[model samples]
Target: MTMLEERPLDEPFAADPATARRQAATSPETADRPRSISSRTFDDRMSLGGSAVASLCLVWLLYTVVLPMSGKLGFVLLWFVAFVLLYAGVTAVSQPGPVVRDRIASAVIQGGAAVVLLVLVFTVAYTFVRGFPAYRHLNFFTQDMSSAGPSDPLTQGGIKHAVVGSLIELGIAVLIALPLGLTTAVFMTEIGGRFGRIVRTIVESMTALPDLVAGLFIYAFLLIALGQERNGFAAAVALSITMLPIIARSADVVLRIVPGGLREASLALGASHWRTVWSVVLPTARPGLATALILGMARGIGETAPVLIVSQPSAYFESNPFHNPMNSLPLFAYTGIRAPDTNSHTRGFGAACVLLATVIVLFVVIRILARQRRARDARPRPWTRLARRASS
Candidate 1:
């Protein structure tokens, strides 16, 4: 055939006149209609500006004229709802129905997130503002509450005892809960059986166990039954009860997500099951495990009821957890806030700020540790580097 009459090898023939006509009719240029309102188009920007102005005007009218005349409280909630509705309606005038719906949904989700973030920021700001008086004093971190009376100045006393006690108790709780929780998690993930299932169920159930109930259990067993005095040890035990379930549940989830191929590969290399878990599985999931432990510590650190029930709130500094009663940040804050004095109120807010700072510091430290571990893992070992150098 001549070149002009030959069909190209890659292109298909339409085979019929009707098919060719249909293909021409459905070309890219005419296949789908262009969007009336697109984010990429300048018209979208104009529509957005129009919607904003209309929403503001509608909200102002409702708040000032309609609500006031109806004897209704013209709160910000009414304004917000009016703004959302008016904005959606105004935008829908130029956009397709589906695009307007999606935009409205996106606005609601983003607005909700912004409101939550603002609430958290304002709460922290308010606490710091109220606590500034006590926090500004050098004595607040150095002296104990023993010498400070109801009318004493903010500079006279500090939360030294509470701070020390809280740290010690939290340390003890971590020491006790970490091993048990991690072991339980390992068993749940690696040694699946009826017993493991039972243990998992119990741990899951304990997640919702009340803080007050845990405190009462410890208080009755130690103080009432054994006739022991209120001390930091008993408080630590109570906190451990609170931390155990959280750590176990979190760690179990972390361990379960570890790739099964790593375990199989380790076993293929002639490692025992326990050795494979220790040398391979655990190392692979270290960051997640650390995160679990941090979460558990956060829950334990903020507990007030357990410490309140088991340990007497002491104003004097006590170093030994075994001997005398010890105070903690939560207990101190609770007591101070209930007092009738302004200094006590300031101290209460200050204690709360310290508690928040402690949690933030712990989270930062743990994140740093996890990042360091990941970086170390990413680097080659000394022996591996030496071998590579020799080969080169």
Candidate 2:
């Protein structure tokens, strides 16, 4: 047989299964046509379609199909939606099989989402920037809010009393919530048993309790205990009730993320558990703890219902927390909203902008400090060495 006439060895052991299959699949007339392209496309489309159907079913099952059996339906729906989206994303990435078109499509989708998000952010920023300066003058924070009628623009009072009251009440609220929440978190994370379960249940229940319910509970209970009328202190206490559980749960989660190995190491060194927790775990989780507190405060700071029930809004500054119905930023916004003048509404918007900015700035500052602290901790122990040398 001639070398060209005889089948090549490569043909017998061809690496391309499709090529081999094509040769086997076709008669002499049909050998020119391809087979794999349509088959692969069909497989890809089938996989993607199956994924899409499954994803849709998952989304629907949680959101539309299922009845709310537990109070946690929102959380379950959240997870279900996340899972569906993730599955869809995986399917999209895998089915396309590294094609340049898929990459381009992904980029375009991402860019569109980014553009939309940027537009929303810029719109918010523009409104705040424009409205903020309307009341950003020095007098805005300095003058008394007393008897400033809507018609009198020049005599319109500053937010001095409200600002001071807010700061004082917030300070008191933080002092109350921080320790209680931190201790609760420590207990939840460090202790185990049926007690842990109970604590967790209590925290979770507290988390789900309505803010107005909390306000009413505190207003009834604490007001009776203290034998006092509604005042700034009562408002602070009400705010603390809503804030504490959140801080505890969040801090507990953060503390749980601390490596058990760290605690074990400290224990192995003959350190007391309490000491180890205080010196090691607390420090490690400090950033997250700070973030949690800041978040809790942010949640409570804008609260109107609780304050309205527990504290009366006053125009003049009052240093006595127990006797005086103090002016608060939220109360100021409320009055401005209900007032008849456009100027008052503008002022309210300005205050709202300030309040929003304050919360955002605190969150950002918390994150920045956390990062800086982590970096500082990560730095070489040169300072320790220097301290040791000095001691020697």
Candidate 3:
């Protein structure tokens, strides 16, 4: 065959015969042609909305009049079920399978998102409102529960000891877990030998390890076998164990997502593997690493079982982890809720609010730090600034 004969013809966009035919068929100018099945017209939107409203009203009527259900929870549940069925059935009548499927997916995703947002808002508001009496007290942050009984008024008792203890234990766990997790992650991503595969498997397995089991592991080995006392150190150890797998797993995933080209570029420029990872890969994935750390912190900090099993609860404020018992927000909340008094319940809710606040603060701090670093990196360099000025 001659090369000139086989040469391709130059054409405008969408100039293929098949594409041209499709465009003509779907064009608004083509009056006799049917509209695209996936296209959502105004009529389609109206039909979908009407279907949803009709389903909701039908569910309400059934729940209130036809059914024995009187609770808000049941009403909402029935509405969701009815809405899904009615919406799908109604859409299928006027639309093709793809359109029906798309509408159903949109409805489910939007409905689920709305429910989750509402639930989260309600939970936060309820916790803050319920804990108002105790949290609003002037001495709440300063006083300890040592001298106060469960029946004592909110004004007389506080979560000072629990707050301090939680911080100390969390600090210890971070110190122990962060480096180890990062090391494990680096090993997995940078050096994936057979041993690395084994390590990855173990980390994944630990991620599903129950909180109670982690507590028991530390309790048996650290508290019993070693003849150690129930203290904050033991609790920190359990928290570390829980946090380690989370941090390592999340970090490994994040590091793996770092662009291989960046690593290659760094190495091609004569950087060692360690230097490339430390300077290029780690810095590139900073935000994700921070997120991984946050997940680990959240998992460990809020654990009640491990702390409860491995560490004794203390009413008095203690600073030394090596000494007597310590108390954390989760443990304090659990114990207080179990006490047979309204005062104790208030304390529990108050501690929960504090725990929530602490987590929020940590999240904000990490986000701010990550953004700040990114902002600095994005700032114009000296030569870039000069070039911009010269251009302007």
Candidate 4:
């Protein structure tokens, strides 16, 4: 019988990086070009266009002459239904049963996605437009609302307090939740037992827990039972409760995607489970972990009820989360928008814009870091370079 070759300890996760790099000069992401390879035929295009036009005509006729429906939303709904039926009918005449079904499905999917995208774009655009005046003032980023009244100009008061409070609260929440969630994820993924399964079941259950209930839980436990003051710390704790399950669930999924081969290799090399996870699994799943962090942060950062319930709103800035009252963007926006004044409305819109921008920026920054990590992994290691030079 032929002898079997064993993998070296140093190269457990993958084969020699030097060999792979030398075999291919460019990374897959760098080498590949994106080009659509859709297989739509002329008849397919004709059927789609004809159906859309016919649907619009039919819907318009129904609204104007047949139906009593006067709402734009109802018209759109009817139009979509008409289009699906028309498209399927038209395709069924010339194409196979499968093709007709596929065409109809594609139209519905595209239509649904278009509606969502349109709604998203409109919302962002509307908020920006409404908040343009407030965003234009230099004081909007520098000043707080301590001295400004409701009738004050956009230039007089700003969301500075809300911004600072949100940062402090979210920062605290991240610190508390990240490690706990990471540990929980590791327990569920690497050291899975009956306890781990129970933890997973609880996490999955909490994943759908509503924002209001999270606030109420914290409110009842900390503010009422423990007699804790309404402050940024309480808000942060509430936010952590909201964030914990999200982070744990997301990290669990991410860690689970780490290859079984890598885990087995690590074990075979005499590494303990903890060491294997720390050195191999965690590092390998870094990007996904970053995504989990983002998801957690995104969920908590914009929470309104938690902040509303457990924290006292303040117009002036508060630096300490453990100290007196604080305000966040969502809370600030909600209060401002509900007030009966144009200035408050402008401030509310501006806060909304800022909140949106914050989330987008955070997402972009983390995604960039994730991309950098992937790119670094794709690059040949230092020892790989040394080995290549010696081999050459």
Candidate 5:
């Protein structure tokens, strides 16, 4: 105290300005800068504005540049960029104090990256809006591709054959893959030992194998066994193999996430492990299993490589699975690309749009079913009270 007083008195004690300000604003003993109200407000507002602008710029860029130009890769990139920018902006805006300012520039950079994504989505949408009007009719869905010729501009060729082929193949593949995949998943999740681990590793690795490889494997195996060439049945087998790995992995993950407590409770009640798994575990995981099946079906339906390798193209409709080559939506698109006229091109685009629509419809149906199931489970049960009464 004595030394401080002496030092201060030397200059008439004008008071070290920073020290005085700090003492008045916050801690009397600590040395720090006192920020004015206007300065703090300005900094905060500037940061918020920058963040907003950055977010908007990112969205704008994505819609304008990347979507229409990039195909599948572009679509994925746009989604990633859009989500990242949006999350960054939200985080920046919600953060407390000075740290909020730091994220603004980062937001700007991310936003810039999103510009290409914006362009891509917009271009695709624009193309759809323009071309969709040409094929948006019931005639497109109800007719077969057989009646139309290469020179016919407005003739009545329908997607019926292609639709039938797609549905049949998809159905067969789903029927074959679901049970096999579900069984494999159950084994991997419930069974223990080195054997289970090996099986799981093999399933996981199969998920990464190319569709063409799966097609070739099936083609070679069947060709050797039955001494026959590729056909619709062959295509279905290939699709099943390709889809099985994905379904198994997804279902395994879902089952593994189930709580051990549930399993223990079922077993403690004298339920066999197999019974508990089938009744309790599977019922609980039904939604995930359905989702996996849907994904498998979708993948198999759109697979061009396996279909191309195993099934020959058909200009005419063939209802018999074994007698003739099956013409699917994917194969139809492939054929259209090689056709030497405007009619073929139009049909290709229309078929593509329909295929895309079908995938979307399946996804929507799954979502609706999931929601309904969830709602049913969420509702209070009159049956529970009835059961309690009966027991008592």
Candidate 6:
């Protein structure tokens, strides 16, 4: 009370005039300073706009100014290089070094993907355009080359025999390769041991073996050694050989990636190893296995040398795989294109288009099957439903 009476009560709380002025001057400077890097925000729209504008300008400049001087052959390369550099530089102006680097990398990857998609679209469009003349004729799909001469119009000839042969041979090849490949994959991934390693090594080695070599092997074994005639069966054998390694290796990799905990859980629940693999592992990896099969089919279906070497290309329909020569889409296209006639050339293109369509159809079917499997897996099983009902 004595001390408070000695000095005014407000004196202790009041700021000195000089210190208050210094604080007032420093506050604005502190507030105006730039934020830390962690607090900074990037304008993605601005970056994207700048990148697009720079890419367009660079492409135009090259097309108009640089092409005359440098030639048009390297336009794509130049454009790619210019766009990447310009985009990176533009981003760097507003972003940190790491962010700029990431942006550049993403741009390059996206550009490459776009280029690939464009190339695929262009190829399909060009093939369809060139083949439309023959494809438009209904007979081109209903008749055989045997009934039509080289001088005949597109309406007179078709790929019926080749289509039949191709289907029969590919069917045989898949029937033989699928089970063997799946078993080998299971052995490699689930039953890994010394034998599995040896099998894996052999599969890896076989993957690099030439298609022609496989054809020659089958040709020698079946036609030369066994004194058998050229037939669709022999062609199917060669195709199976070519397809086996592809399916086995791809499936092995797919199966290996299936969660080990699932297998352990199954085993702990008193299931046998084989049962666990069949019920749990295979079901989990079925979609991936289907993809592997598709790859195998794609590799085998387009092979001309194997079918050409092992089976004589037939012009007439021959459904028997074991006795007589057989025709296929690849052989049909090859033989047709060799004929010195415009109609024949058109037929060849038409056959190629048909083959392409067949592949597309197969891919769509496989995708649908995969989607159905995924949907089925997402639904509760009957046992699971029963268990839930019992619990309730």
Best by lDDT: 3
lDDT leaderboard ranking: 3, 4, 1, 6, 2, 5
The clash number for model 2 is 0
Number of clashes found in candidate 4: 0
Off by over 4 Å in 2: 1-123, 126-130, 379-392
What tens-digit string does per-residue lDDT give for candidate 3 at 37-120? 566789778877887799888988888889787988978888888888888987776555676788889889999999999999
Judging by TM-score, tell me the better candidate of 5 and 6. 6
Candidate 4 residue lDDT tens string, 141-253: 88889989889887698889999999989999999999999999999998899999999999999999998998899999988999988999999999999999999999999
What's the TM-score of every candidate structure?
Answer: 0.84, 0.68, 0.85, 0.86, 0.72, 0.82
Candidate 2 or 3, higher lDDT?
3
Better of 1 and 5 by TM-score: 1
Model 6: lDDT equals 0.86
The better-scoring model by TM-score among 3 and 4 is 4
178-211: candidate 6 lDDT, tens digit per residue? 9999999999998889998999999999999899
Off by over 4 Å in 6: 1-71, 382-392
- Count clashing residue pairs per candidate: 0, 0, 0, 0, 20, 0
lDDT of 1 by residue, 173-282 (tens): 99999999999999999997999999999999999999999999999999999998999999999999999999999999999999999788667666678977887788
> How many Å off is the CA of 152 in candidate 1?
0.4
Native-to-model Cα distance after best TM-score fit, residue 366 in candidate 1, in Å: 0.9
254, model 2: CA deviation in Å?
0.8
Off by over 4 Å in 1: 1-27, 30-53, 68-74, 381-392
Q: After superposition, how far is residue 244 of candidate 2 from its true place, in Å?
A: 0.5
Error of 1 at 134 (Å): 0.6
